[model samples]
Target: MLFTDLARSLPATIPFVGPEALERRMGVKFRARLGANESVFGPSPMVLEAMAEAARESWAYGDPEQYELKRAIADHHGIGMENIAIGEGIDGLLGHLVHLAAVPGDRVVTSYGAYPTFNYHVAGHGARLDFVPYRADDHEDPEALAARARDVRPKLLYFANPDNPTGSVHDAATIGRLIDAVPEETILVLDEAYSDLAPDGSLPPISLMRPNLLRFRTFSKAYGMAGVRVAYVVGEPAAIAQFDKVRNHFGVSRMAQAGALAALADQDHLRATIIRIAHAREELAAIARRANMTPLPSATNFVAIDCGGNGDYARTLLAAVLKRGVFIRMPGVEPLDRMIRVSVGTPDDLALFEDALMGAIAEVGRPTAT
Candidate 1:
């Protein structure tokens, strides 16, 4: 085979199977697309206009420097333009970081059952991964991760604030301690993908920069441009420069840049979207309560509702929900997997999910005592 040894050794996999694939497999169109945590509310009007205008200029490749968008982002965060590196999304930037930092056999550390995509990138590079388990409260345990990183001195340590799967978050002080604790040799890959939706005080200051820490934020969430695929990493200028060595210069499209620029300019639209997501999140929690499942406290746009059972019960309920034309997701590993994750959606979308949840419970029934 022409493939490299590293490529050959890695399994063919994606971070998550998208809802389209599920719709095809199940032979039913999802009446409500609540899975995958996409912003069902869509992007701002100005973003649509900007992207539309840029579409006519699509024949030209996006500027490799991405100067305007980077400048806008830097100004927005009160950081210098040198501190930014743009990419397809946080996922793509992460891949570049892994390639830039970790060679074969280098160690990387992340929480078990955190963002699987980061783990996928680590595996692709043939780096060894050491996992620290999530806390009993379902939050990623920063102190535990810090201890492990100190011991292993891994090339990269991945931590997501307002984390995926469980939608849990720690205060800025706790995150600040974790940031300080990371070993000098290790690059702290701080993923703040859901930062726009995060409650006040859940994020550190944008001006905070460390040579070994890179913070990733995206237009995909509150900006409602997931399909546009634009995200950037913020760090000290020297640390951010390394991404240029491995990133595809033109990977972020012209339309994406235009859309994200407009999205950033329109703070009103972003704030309104956040409010809508919060309301939807509350409705989702209420739906969970109506069905007797416990909704985990969330600072992001989704809720992880405890099914009050084991992984098996959650999986069964998820499958039933899918069968009923409502799409949702769950964590794949133990303990965390006992909850179903439903993204914030429209009133009609939540209505579909509520109906589906009740029916799924009726079909699968609840878990009995051991």
Candidate 2:
């Protein structure tokens, strides 16, 4: 009973603890479920109907090629179908890409305290991680990242546009500059999980001209298909074709494909959901302000509120909220970890959050005067 060296070194714990697991541990249901950044609004009605229709065909395996969904995605993004690669989710796709690009001992560059899932995948493949501190202004410093890439000449560089935990976003101009600075041999993995909620001009336009850059998008956020787990990557045809060498052929389920296709077709539903999410973000920010906390401006479906203290104080607040049955999360590192992240939800959900948060604050005692 021996495990591979790589598997043996990896921690036995799951990276994310879902809300259900937490509920089971605490022996109570959460009054406000805002953690995990899921779309509480749920999927579009059209998507639901499409999934129901596809349910009858669930006995059949999905098209291994993923032709229809890929074409829909390509047309929506104004890209060629050959340039797209579909997968279970961005998480699954990331693992495959890291395996393809990085060999053991190769360097993989990412911002300190960025997406842990990417780091997890890189480590699983025995790649060395090179972390650059996040910018003081809260955005990813493209110049700093570029400098590290140049110095280390890492095989892969990963970043999320509207960064998780902090919800800070880098503009298109900044991203373009980083692209120009990266070495030709290095693969730039841009995780745009929150792209749909981003403000106009926030993301770089689709440009397959760059051979080294790969951008990932998901139906999990604004489209409200997280359970469906539909995500895709856009890059040069050569880069996309490489996925065929390693990806799970029938990984994308028929139900998921149908739901995603219907989701994509209903532009109105997507637009309405984005608008609602934007409003929820603002409402959450206002709630933070009234509570004397600072809510960082976000381009995502969640808001990170500066808890007006250190990581310990944030944890205390988190625990208090949990006691009140409101589920939320905070960063795992210093500086950024001083804030707790709350996902946008429906009005009733927000009401529960507000009540639970106020109750939690009361239970934790008032902030001390400096």
Best prediction by lDDT: 1
lDDT of each: 0.93, 0.89
Which residue runs of candidate 2 sit more than 4 Å off their true CA positions?
A: 366-370
* Tens digit per residue, CA lDDT, model 1, 1-370: 7999999988999789998999898898999988888899899999999999999999999899999999999899999999999999999999999999999999999999999999999999999999999999999999999999999999999999989989999999999999999999999999999999888999999898899989999999888998899999999999999998888998999999999999999999999999999999999999999999999988888999999999998999999999999999999999899999999999999999999999999999987764
Clashes of each: 0, 0
Error of 2 at 3 (Å): 2.6
Model 1 vs. true fold: TM: 0.99
| All-Cα superposition RMSD per candidate | 0.8, 1.3
Candidate 1: which pairs clash? Answer: none
Give the C-alpha miss distance for residue 203 in model 1, angstroms: 0.9
Candidate 1 Cα errors over 4 Å, as ranges:
none
